[model samples]
Target chain A: MHPAPSVIIFTALSGLGFGLMAWLGFGLPAVSGWSAFTFFFVAYALAVGGLVASTFHLGNPKRAIKAFSQWRSSWLSREGVLAIVSLLVIAVYAIGVIFLNQRWQIAGWAGALLSLGTVFTTSMIYAQMKTVPRWNTPLTPVLFFLYALAGGALLAGQTGAAIMLLIVLCSVQVLAWVLGENSFARAGHTIETATGLGNLGRVRLLESPHSGPNYLLKEMVYIVGRKHAHKLRVIAIFLMGLVPVAILTLLPTNHYMAAIAVLSHMAGLFVSRWLFFAQAEHVVGLYYDKR
Target chain B: MTSLPQSTQKKLGLAIDLDTCVGCHACVISCKEWNTSNYGSPLSDMDAYGAEPSGTFLNRIHTYEAKTLERAAQVVHFPKSCLHCEDAPCVTVCPTGASYKRSEDGIVLVNEDDCMGCGLCAWACPYGAREMDVAEGVMKKCTLCVDRIYNENIPEEDRVPSCVRTCPAGARHFGDFADPDSNVSILSAERGGFALMAEQGTNPVNRYLPPRPKADISGSGQIGVPATALGEETGGAKGFLSWLDKALEKI
Candidate 1:
C-alpha cells in the first residue's frame, strides 16, 4: 500500500512490454532486419527491466532466485515462473522472426499465449490477495489483462486493435473503479467481526496498542485522502482511457498520435495502479478501524 | 513443500480469555524481551528514543469499547498473533517457501534463512500477524515460541510460549488444540471460544474467549442509609458553623 515506485514501474512497463511481445509474436508489424530487431530489443528491455525492478523492493534481492521454487502453491511464485517462461519463449520467437525470417506460427502462438498467461499470473499475484478485498476480485485480472492487451496494441501501432481494446478496457476500468469503491464500503467484516466480538452490540477503537507506528500500521493502514483520490481517479480515467481513445479515433493512424496514446495510457495506468494499492483496505485493518 | 498437508498431526495454539484480561501488557513486554533475543531478529527499533518510535513485532494488543447499551459499555483488550491456520494464506502465498506451517505441531514459522522478506506473506495474512524485521531483512512471526516450547535445555514446566507464561491475569493459554482433552479445547468447548475473522476461511487454530457476563455495577455496593451519621445531633443547626462542627467531630 506504500505504492513503492519500483513496483509501479514494474507493473506498467512489463505489462506494456509483454503486450507488445504478444502482438509481435503474431507477426503483427510484419517487418524484418533492423526494424524487427529494434522492436524485439524494446520489448525484452521493458519486460526484463520491469522484472528486475520488482526485486529492488525486496528486503533481500540477492535471494530472489529462491522465489522460483514455490510454484506449486504460491501465485507470486507462479508469476515469477511464468514471467521467466514467457521471456524465454519470447526470446526464441524473436530470434526466429529476426534471424530466420520465419514466423513459426506454432512457436509464435505459444509465445503469445505464454506472454498473456504471464500477465494473468502477475494479476493473480494481487488478485489472489484475499486480505485486500479491493484486489480480491475477478475484475482485478480483467482490468490487468485489458491494460496489457490495450497497451500492447497501442505500442505495436495496431490502430484497429488498439481502438477496440481501448473501448472495452475503458468500460472495464469503469467497472473496476465502481467495484473497488464498493469493496470497503460494503465489506463483510467490521471492527466487531475483526475482533471476534459480534455479540457486542457496537465496537469502537478506544486506544491503539502502540503509541508509535509499527510494521502492520505502516504497511496496512495506508489512508489516501478522499478528495485527492477522487481528483486523481478522474485524471487517471481521462488520461488513460478517454484521451487515448479520443486521440486514436481522431488521428486514426498518425505515428505521433500513437506514441502520445501509449505514453498517456502508461501514465494514466500508473496513477490508477497507485490508487489501487493506496486505496486497498486489508480486512485486518478493520481491527484498527482503518476502513 | 509449499503445498499443505492433508491434515496436521497437531494444532498447537493459544486461547485468550478476554473476560479476565486486565490489559496489563505484561505479555506484550515479556514476548518482546524473550523474542527479541531468542528469535531470528532483535526486533530493531527506529527512532526508539526519538519523537516517533517504530519497530517490528509479531503480537499486539488491540483495545476496544464494546457498547451494548448507551449506558453499558465494556472495554475489551484483544491480544492477537498468528493463528497458524489450517488454511493459512500466509503459508501458501509465500513466494520463497520461507513461510510454512508445521505438519507435526501446526506452528506457523518463518525459515528466516530462506526468506527474502518480499512481504507478500504479510499482505496475505488477514490477522496482521506477520512482521518484517528491518535489521535482518526477513519476515518474523510468533513461532508459538517454537525454540523454547520444545527446547530440552529449558525446564519442562517453562516450555510454553512467553506470552502465555507471563500473562499476569492468566488469560493467555497455550496448548495442543488437536487434543480434545487439552485445556484450550476444553475451555473452547465450555466458554465457546471463537476464532477471529472466521469468514476469511483461514480456519484459525487460535481463539478468543467471549467476554463473560459482568455483575451489575450499580446498586449492589451502595449504602441505603448511614447507621452512625454525625449530622444526626446537628440536623436543626444553623448555617456552616454547625455543619463543620459535625463533620469535624466525625473525622
Candidate 2:
C-alpha cells in the first residue's frame, strides 16, 4: 500500500467526524440552539470534508455516484450509502435540536447508530481484503471502532469517558501493532506458494516481468523502511493516545486545553492511519519476492 | 450484480507450459500489440520515452529458479495473466457494478463506462492481474481476447488470443476447461497443471504445467571426456614441435 495522502486524510478525519456525530446524537453535551449549531457544523465539516477528499484519489471521481450501486456485495458501496444516509439522519436530528430545542431521544439514538454503522462500513472496506493479511482480522474493525469512540469522547468534552477510552485504545493499538507484525508470514503466503513451485524446491524470483515498475508493484509492493516505521509508530502513539490522556488527566477543564487535546489526538490519528496503509503487506508481493 | 454466476457454460482459459516456454516474451509483446488496438481502451503508457516508463500490460512473464537439495537448480519462465476464477474477489470487491464475470464463457471483464476507478478490485486480486490504466483511469486486465476469440471478421484460424497465436514455442494453450475432452483439459490432466495460490480458494480457470525434472549428469564419467581428449591432442602437437627443434639444433 502506498499510503496515499487522500485516503489517510479521509479515514482519520471522517472517523473523528462520525464519532463526534454519534456523541452529539446521544446528547452527550446536551447542547441546543447556537451551541448545537456549532457542534453540528464542525461534525458535518469534518465528515463531509473527509468524504470529499476521498474522491481525489479516484481515477475517475466523476463516476463515483455509481459506487453506491453494489452495496449488497461491496463494503465500499455500503460505506458510501451508509455515510449519506447517516449524514441525512443526523442532519434532521440536528435541525430539530438547533431550531426548536427539541430532543427526540429515539431519533437521536437512531441517528447515532447509523453514524457508527457508517464508520464500521468504512473499516470493512479495508478489513475485508484477504489479500492484505495484516488487515484481514477482527482486530482491524475493533481498532477502528475504538479510535472513533475515543476521538468522539474527547471532541465532545467528556473527559471522564475520553480518559477511559483512550487508555483502552492505546492498549489495543499497541496490541494490534505487535500482532500485525507477523500476520503476513502467519498467513502462509510465500514465493513458493505464489508460484505453486514448492514441490520442485525453494523458489526464488530471478527476474521481474518488466524492467520498469508497473501498476501492481507501485500500488501493492510498497516497502516502508523498518527504522522509519518504528520511529513513526512511537510518535503516533505519543501524540494520538498518550498526549490526549495526559492533557485531560493533569490540566483543569478549559476550552483551550480541550482544543489542544483534540488537535494532538487528530494529528496522531493521521500518522497512525498512514502507518495502517503503509505497513500492510499484500500477498501479491510474493510474486515479486517483496515483503 | 457484482456477485458471480452460479455456473459458466464454458471455462475458457489458457494452459501455459512452463517446461516448454523459453521466456522470449513474444506472447507479452504480441498481447500488448493486439490488446491495445482491439480492446475498449488502448493500453496507455506514461512517460513512455522518458526516464521512468510504465505501461499497462495484460500478460507478463516472470522467470524463477527452483532449487532442491537432491536436484540441480532449474530455471522456469512463468507467464501470468488473469485467472478468471469461479470466485473472483476482484469482481465482487468492485464498488461499482463495473467488474463482472460472464456466465457464457467465464471471462472476467470490466465495463469501463461504469467504472469509478477506485481500484478496490485490483487490491482484492491476489495474483495482481488487474491494472489501473494511468491514461484512461480505468481498470484493465486480460479479457482472454474477447474481441478476437468471437470476432467473425477475423479468420477462423486466427480466432484465439494473440498471445496463444503468437507463442513461438506453442507453450500457450487456449480452450474451454469445462469440456472433459478439450485440449486444455487433457493437457492439464496429463501434465499435473496446478493453480497459483490455490489457498486463496479462487478456483482459477487458468492452470500452469510445472517444469519437468531436468536430467542430471554430475556423476557421469563423460562429464570431462571432451576436455581430456582436447588436452591429449594439444600434447601431441607440443611433442612434434620439440622434436623439430632438436633436429634444427643438430643441423
Candidate 3:
C-alpha cells in the first residue's frame, strides 16, 4: 500500500499520544495530588492533538460523521466512534479533576479505560484488513497497544516508577517488532497468490500498464531495497527498543537523559512506521509490473 | 415500512472461460467501443500524437503464465473488468451514495452526476476496478453494457453485452446467476470456476475457469542403431559392396 503521510503520522503520533494517556491515566491517581494534575494535563493534550491530526486523513473531512454509522461492520467507523468516546471521557475526567472533587477517582478510572479503548480502536483500523495478512494478525493490535504504552511511559514524568515502566515497555516493543517481522514474511506468500499466480514461486514483472506512472503504481508499489529495509529494521529495533531500555536501566537517574531517550524512541518509531507502509506490498502491486 | 420480496430478485454476472480464450483482446475493444459511445461521455484519449496518451478503458486483457517451467511458457489471458461483487466494497465506501448496487439485478453502478470525485471508493476496492473520469470529474466502471443489454429495439437474442457478443472465441458468457438453471451458473459449476483473491471475501460475481492441461514438451535422450547391423567385409569385392551399402544407408 502506498504510504499516505497523513495516515502514517496519525497512527504513529496517536500511538504515542494514546500510549502516554493510558500510562498517565492509570498511574496519576497513585501519584501525589499536584504531580497527578500536571501529568494528566500533558497526556490529555497529546491524545487530543493526535486525534485532531488524524482528521486530516479524510478526503472530505466534513462527511466524517458518516463514518460512525457503520461501526457494526466497519472497523474504520468503530475507530472514529471510539475516538470520539475517548475524547468525551477525557473531557469529563478533566472537569472532575478541576471542579468535581467528589467524582475525581471514578472519573480517572474511566479515563484510563477510555485511553486503552482508543489504542485498541486505532489498532483495529489496520488489523481488520484481512486481505493484508500482515495487518490481519492478532499481533498487530497487541503491538499497537504495546507501542502506545511504551511511548506513553517514556514520555510520562521521570520518576523511579516511570523509569521501570519504560524498561518494561521497551522489552515488549522489541518482542512485538520481532513478531511483526515474522508476520510480514508469512504475508509475502499470500500476496503472491493474490496476483492470480498459482504458487509461491518467484513472480517477476515483465511489463507495466502505464508509461510514466499511474496512481495504482504510485500508491501500492513502494520500492524499498532489501538491504535498506534490513538497515532500517536494525535501526528501529536498536533506537526504539534497545537504546531506550538501556538508557532507562544503565544510565544515571537523570531526567534529561530519560527525556532524550523518549525523543529518540519517537524518531525511531517515525522510521519504523515509514518502513511499515513502504514494505507492505499491496496485491495491486502485482499489476504494476514491478515486483 | 414495506419490504420487497427476495424471490423476485436476480443476480446477474459474467462467466469467463480461460481454456478457450485466444487472448485476442476483442472483448476489451468491444467494451471500449460500446461504453464510450453509449453509457455517458466519450472515454477521451488525452493525446494520440503527443508523448503521453491515456484514456479510460472499461475492460483490459491481462496475460500471465500459470505455473510454467519453459522459457516461452503457455500464457493464460485474463479478461478483466469489474467483477461487480455482491459485497461491493466500492459501493459501501462511497461517501456520496453515488455508487450503488442494484437490488433487483445485483449490478453495481455509479451515478456520474452525483459523484464528487472523492476517490474513496477506488481506495476501498481491492480489484482496482474503478477509475476516475478526468473530463467528467466522476468515477466510471464496467456497467456490464447496461445500455446495450436492455435495449428493446435490438432483438432479444442479440441484446447481450457488446463484449460477450464480440468475443471471437466465445470466452465470455453473461446471464442471471441467481437462477440455478442459467447458462453462466451451469458453465461455472461444470468448469469449476475460481474467483480471483477469494481470500479477500469480496464474493465477486465474475468467475474464471482454470486453463486446461497440455501435453509435456520434454525431449527423450537416445543413440543411433548398433554397429553389428553392418555386413562383414570379406575381400576386395565384399568390402566394395559393404562401402556401397553404407553409402546407400546414408542416403
Candidate 4:
C-alpha cells in the first residue's frame, strides 16, 4: 500500500485510545474516589486525542459533516459516525465518574461497548474493500480490538498504574498476534486466488505497458524481504506482546521499568502497524511489472 | 424527461479473440481515433513530436512471451481496455455519483460535468482502464465507441463500434451478450472465453480467448543437420565449384 499516514496514525492512535478506555472501564469499578477519577480522565483524554489525530486524514475537513450521512452503505462513513458516537459516550462516562456517582456504573459499561464499536468501525474501513483480499477478513476487527487493549494496558503501565491490567492486556495481545499471523497467511492465499494462480505455480510478470512505476504498482506492490519481515514480526511480537507482559509481571513495584515497558510496547505497536500495511499484498499487485 | 416503454434491455459487449490477434495495434488506434473525437473528452497527446511523447489511449495491446522450451516461445497479445463490468467497483465507490452504470446496457460511464477530479474511481478500478485527462481535469476511458454505436445517422451494420469495424483480422466482435445467438456470445462459448482477474468479482463483460498453437510457421520438422542434397555427392572442391557454376548457369 502507499502507506497513507492518515490511516496509519488513525489506526495506531485509536488503538491506544480505545485500549485505554477498555482498561479504565473495567478497572474504574475496583478503585475508589480520586484514583478512579484520575484514571477515567486520562483514558477520556487519550480517546479524544486519538479522534482528533484521525481528523487530519480527511482531504477536506469541511466535508466531514457529510461523512455521517453515508453510514447506511459505506464502512468509512460508519467509522466516522461511530467514532464520534464513541467519543460522546466516553465523555458522558467521564462526567458520570467525576460528578454523577449513581450513574457512573451504567455510563462506564456504555463507554466500554462504544469503545469496541469504534475499533470495529475502524477495521471495517479496510475490510469493506472486497477488492483487497488482504483486508477482507473477520480477523481484521478482532486484531484491531486486541491491539487497542494491548496498547491501553501498556499506556496504563507507563502512567504508574494497573500492572495487573497490563499483564492481561499483553496476554490478549499475544493471542491477537497469533491469530493475525494465521489470517495474514490465509490472506496471501486469497491474493493468489484473486490472480487466478495456484500455490505451486510461478506467476511472473511477462509484460508491463508503463516503463516507470504507476499508481497501482506504487500503492499495492510493496516489496519487503522475507528475512527482514520475519525479523520484524518477531520483534513486534516480543515488544508489543511478551516483553511488556514480562516487565509488568517481574517488576510490578518498579514504576520506571513499567514506564519503559509501556514505551517499548507503543514503539512495537507502531512497527506492527507499519508491517500490517507493508506486508499486505493487494490483488492489484499481480498487475505490477516486478513481482 | 420522456420515459421509454418498459422492456428488458439487453447488455451489449465485446468478446476479443486473443488467439487471432496479431498485435498489429489496429484496434488501439481505431479506438483512440473514435473515442478521442466523439467521447466525453478527447484523449490528448502531451508531446506529439517531442523526445518524450505520452497520451491517453482508450485501448492498448500488451505482448507477453511465455518462455518454455517444451512449447518453444509463444507470444500472447492482450488488448486491454474497459471491461464495462456489471458490478463495477469504480461506479459504486464514486462519492459524487459521477461514475455510474447504464441500466439500459450495463455500460459503466462517467459524467464529466459532475466529476470532481477526486481520482477515487481510478483507484477503485483494477484494470487501470481509467486515465485522467490533464487538460480537462476529468477521467477518460474507453466508451466502447458509445457515440458511434448509437448514432442514428449511421447504418445498422456500421453502427457496431469503430474498433470492431476497423479490425482487419476480425479480432474484435461487438454484440449483445444477453442474446445467446449473438456473434460475440457464440464466439465466447465456442472459444472457452475467460475473463481477466475474474476473482475480483467485478463481473467484467469482456472476455479473452487463449492463444492457439503455432503450427504453420515452424516449417517441416527437421531435427538437426540438413539432408544430403538430393542424390548427387560432388565431394571435392573442384566438383562443388563446377556444380555451383552449373546451378548459377541454370538460374
Candidate 5:
C-alpha cells in the first residue's frame, strides 16, 4: 500500500470526528447553549472536513455523488451514505441541545448509533479486501473502533474513559501487529500460486512487464515505508497511548493539560494511521515478486 | 448496479498457452495500440519519453524462471490481463455503479462517465488487472477489446480481441467458455488449463496452460563430448596442460 496522505488524513480525522460526535450525542459533557454549540461545531467541522478531504484523492471529485449509489454491495458507498445520515441526524440533535437547551434523548441515541455505524462502514472499506491479507482480518474493525472510541473520549474530555480505552487500544495495536506479521504468508499467496506454476517448480520473476513503473507498482507494491515500521510503531504507541494516559493521570486536572493531551493523541493517531496503510502488504505484490 | 448478475449468458474469456509464449510481448503492444484509440477514453502516458516513463496498459507480459530438483530450469512468459471472473470483486467493490459485468456476454466493463476514480476497484482486484489512467482519472482495464469483438464495423476475421488477434506465437485464444464445445473450453480441457490463484475464489474465466517440461539432455553423448583416454595411445601434455587434460576428462 502507498500510504496515501489524503486517505490517511481522511480516515484519521473522520474517525476522531465521528467518535466525538458519538460521545456528544450521549451527552457526556451534558452542556447546553453556548457550550453545546461549541462542542457540536467542533464535531461537525472535523467529521465534515474529513469527508471533504477524502474527495481530494478522487480523480473526479465532481462525480463523487454517484458514490452513494452502491451501498448494497460496496462498503465505500455504505460509508458515504452512513456518514451523511449520521451528520444529518447529529445536526438535528445538536439543534435541540444548543438552541432549545433541551436534550432530545431518543434523537441523540439514534445519532450516536449512526455515527458509530459510519466509522464501522469506513473500517469495512479496507477490511473487506481479500487482496490485502494484513487488513482482511476482524482486527481491522477492532483497531478502527478502538481508535475512534479513545480519540472520541480524549476530545470529549472523558478522562477515565480515555485512559482505559487508550490502554486497551495500545494492547490491541500490539496484538494486531504480532498477528499481522505472518498474515501474508498465511494467506498462501506466492509467485508460484500467483502464476499457477507450482507444479513446475519454485517461481522467480525473471523480468518485469515494463522497464519502468506502472499503476500497480505505484499503488500496491510500495515497500519503502516498511523499513522504519518498527521504530514508527514504538513512537506511535508512546505518543498515542502512553503520552495522553500519562498526562491525564499524572497532572492535576486542568483545561491546559487536557488540551495538550488531546493534541498529543491526535498527532499520535496521524502517525499510527500512516503506519496502518504503509505496512499493509497487498497480495498483488506477490505477482511482482515483492512484499 | 455494483451487484453482479446471478449468471452471465456467456462466459467469454481467453485461454493462454504458456508453452507457446516466447515473451515477445506483441499482445501487450497490440492491446495498447488498439485500445488507446477505440475505448471509452484513450489510455494515457506520463512523461513517456522522459527519464521515468509509465503508461496504462490493459495487458502485460511477466517472465518467470521456474526450477525443480528433478528438472532443468524453465523460463515461462506469462501474459496477464483481466480474467473477467464469474464473481468479479472489482465490480462489487465499486462505490459507484460504474464497474459492472455484462449479463449478456459476461464482459466486465467500466462506465467512465459515472466513475469518480476512488480506485477501490483496483485495490479489490487480486490480479492487478485494473489500472487508473493518470490523465482520464478513471479506471482502465482489459475490456477484452469489447468494442472490436462486437463491432460489425471491423472485418469478420478481426472480431477477436486485439491481443488474441495480434499474438505472434498463437499463444492467445478467445471464445465462450460457457459452451463446453467452444474452442477455449476444448483447449482448456485438452491442455489441463488451470486458473490463476484459485484459492482466492475469483473463479476466473481465463485459464493458463502450464508450460511443457523441458526434456533432459544431460549425458546424451550427442551433447556431452566423449571422454578421451589420454596418455594411453597418444602422448598427453605434461605439467599444467596435463592437469587441465585430466580435469577435462573428469568433466
Candidate 6:
C-alpha cells in the first residue's frame, strides 16, 4: 500500500508491454520486418525492463531466481514463470513473423494467450490479497485487464480497439473507486471485535500500537484523503479516456495527435496505478486504528 | 514444499491472558533479546543509539484502551506475534521455499537462507505478524522459539518461548494444543478463549482470553454500588455522595 515506485513502474510498464505483445501476436498493425522489429523491441523493453525495475524493491535482488520454484501455490512465482515462458513464446512468434514472414498460427495464438496470462498473473498478485478488501474483489482483475488492453491497443496503433477499451476501462475505474470507497461495509469485525470487547460495548483505540512508523504501519496503512482522490480520478479520466478518445476520434490519421494521445494515456494510467496502491486498505491497519 | 502438511503432529502455540497482562513490554524485550542471538540472524536496528531508533521485532505488545458501555475503560495489553495458522497464507504466498510451517510442531518459520525478502508473505498475512529484516535481506518472524524449545542445552523449564518464559504475570502460555488436556487447551476451554480475527479463516492456534466483564462502571464511583459503597445509601443522598467521595480518594 506504500505506492512503491518500483512496483508502480513495473505494473504500468509491463501492462503496456504485454498488452503490445498480445496485440502483436493477434496480427494487428501489419507491418514489414523493420517496423515489426521496432515494435517488438519497444514491447520487450517495456515488459523486460519493467521486470528488472521490480528487482530494485527486493531486499536481496540476487536471490530472485529462487522465486520460480513455488509456482504451485504462489501467484508471484506463477507470474515469474509465466513472464519467462510468455517472453520465450513471444520471441519465437516474433522471429517467425518478422524474419521468416510466416504467421506460425499456433505460435502466434499461443503467444498472445500466454502474454495475457502473464499480465493476469501480475494482477492476481494484488487481487488475491485478502488483506486489502478493496482489491480482493473480482473487479480487480477485470480493471487490470481492461487497462492493459486499452494501453496496448493505443500503443499498437489500433485506435478502434483502443477507443473502445479506454471508454470501458475509464467507466470501470470510476466504478472501482466508488465500490472501493465503501469496500469495508460488510467487514467481519469492528474495533470492538478486534479487541474481543464486543459484549462489553463500543471500543476505541485510545493508545496506538506505537508512536513511530512500524513495518506494518509504514507498509500497509497507506491513506489518501477522499477530496485528493476525487481530483486525481478526474485528472486520470480526462487524460486517460476523454482526451485520448477525443484525439483519436477527431484526428484519425494525424501521427502527432496519435503520439500525444498515447503519451497522455500512459501518464494518466501511472497516476491511477499510484492511487490503486495508495487507497488500498490493508486489514492489519485496523489493528493500529489507522484504517 | 510450500504445501501444508496434511497431518501436523502438534499445534504448539501461545495462549495470552488479557485479564492479567500489565502492558510492561517484558515479553517484547525478552523475545528480542533471545531471538537476536538465536537460530536466525540478528534482528537489525536501523539506528540503534540514535535520535530515531527502530528495529525488526517478531513480537510486539499492542496496548489498547477499551471503552465499553458496560464498564469503565480498561487497558488491554495485547502481545501479538505469529499465530502459526493451520491455513497460513504467509507460507503459501512465499515465492521462494523460505517460509514454511513445520509438520512436527505446526510452527510457521522463515528459512532465512532461502528468503529473498520480497515481503509478499508479509502482505499475505492478515495479522501484520511478519517483519522484513532489511539488513539481513530476509523476512523475520516469531519462530515460536523453535531453536530453544528443542534445545537440550537450555534448562527444561526455560525451553518454552522467551516471551512465555519472561512474562512475570504468567499471561503468556506455551503448549501443544493438539493434546486435548494440554494446559493451553484447558485454559481456552475454561476461560472462553477465542482466536484473534477468526473470520480471517487462518485458524490460528493462539488464543486470547477476553477479560471477564465487571459491573457497569460507565459513571459514578466507577461501579455504581461497589461493595465498598454498600450501607451508605441508608444515611441519605448526602451521605451516599460522601461515601462515593471516599471511594474517589485515589483521584
Residue A176 local lDDT, model 4? 50
lDDT (0-100) at residue B247 of candidate 4? 89
Worst 10 residues of 1 chain A by lDDT: A218-227
Candidate 6 residue spans exceeding 4 A from truth: A224-227, B215-232, B235-251
Please give the CA lDDT of all the candidate structures.
0.85, 0.91, 0.67, 0.65, 0.92, 0.86
Report the lDDT tens digits of candidate 1 across residue range A162-246.
8899889888887888878878656577777788776776888888889887888778787755458888988898888888888
First chain TM-score, candidate 5: 0.99
Cα displacement (angstroms), candidate 6, residue B74, comes to 1.4
Instruction: Show model 1 residue runs off by greater than 4 Å.
Output: A185-187, B217-251
Q: Rank the candidates by DockQ, best first.
A: 5, 2, 1, 6, 3, 4
lDDT of 5 by residue, B1-251 (tens): 88999999999999999999999988988999999998789999999999999999999999998877655678999999999999999999999899999998899999999999999999999999999999989999999899898889989989999999999889999999999999999999999999999989898999999887677753322332443522143244889888887888899
Instruction: For candidate 1, write residues B1-251 as lDDT tens digits.
Output: 57777789999999999998888888888888899999787888889899999887777888988865423677888888888999998999888989888889888888888999899998999898988888778998988999889989999978999999999899999998999999999999999999888888889999899999776552323334353542344555777977788888899
TM-score of each: 0.92, 0.94, 0.76, 0.73, 0.94, 0.94
Candidate 5 segments exceeding 4 Å error:
B219-251
lDDT accuracy of residue A86 in candidate 2: 91
How much DockQ does model 2 earn?
0.69
DockQ values, each candidate: 0.67, 0.69, 0.19, 0.17, 0.75, 0.60
- What lDDT score is found at residue B77 in candidate 4? 65
Q: Which parts of model 3 have CA positions greater than 4 angstroms off?
A: A27-45, A99-103, A158-207, A250-255, A287-291, B1-9, B20-58, B70-72, B86-103, B108-126, B130-169, B199-201, B213-251
After superposition, candidate 4 runs with Cα above 4 Å error: A23-65, A99-107, A128-133, A156-204, A224-227, A252-259, B1-9, B24-60, B88-100, B109-170, B216-251
lDDT of 5 by residue, A141-232 (tens): 99989998999999898999999999999999999999999998899888889999988889999999999999999899888868899999
Interface RMSD of each: 0.9, 0.7, 5.1, 6.1, 0.6, 1.5
True contacts kept of each: 0.86, 0.82, 0.11, 0.09, 0.87, 0.66
**Residues A1-291 of candidate 3: C-alpha lDDT, one tens digit per residue:** 666777777788877777766665564445544555666676666666676766665434565555566555555556667777766776676665555543455655676677788789778766655444556678778778777877787777444554565556556655655665666446554434555546423444443334444445555566745348778877876778767777877888687887788878888887778876776655555554443
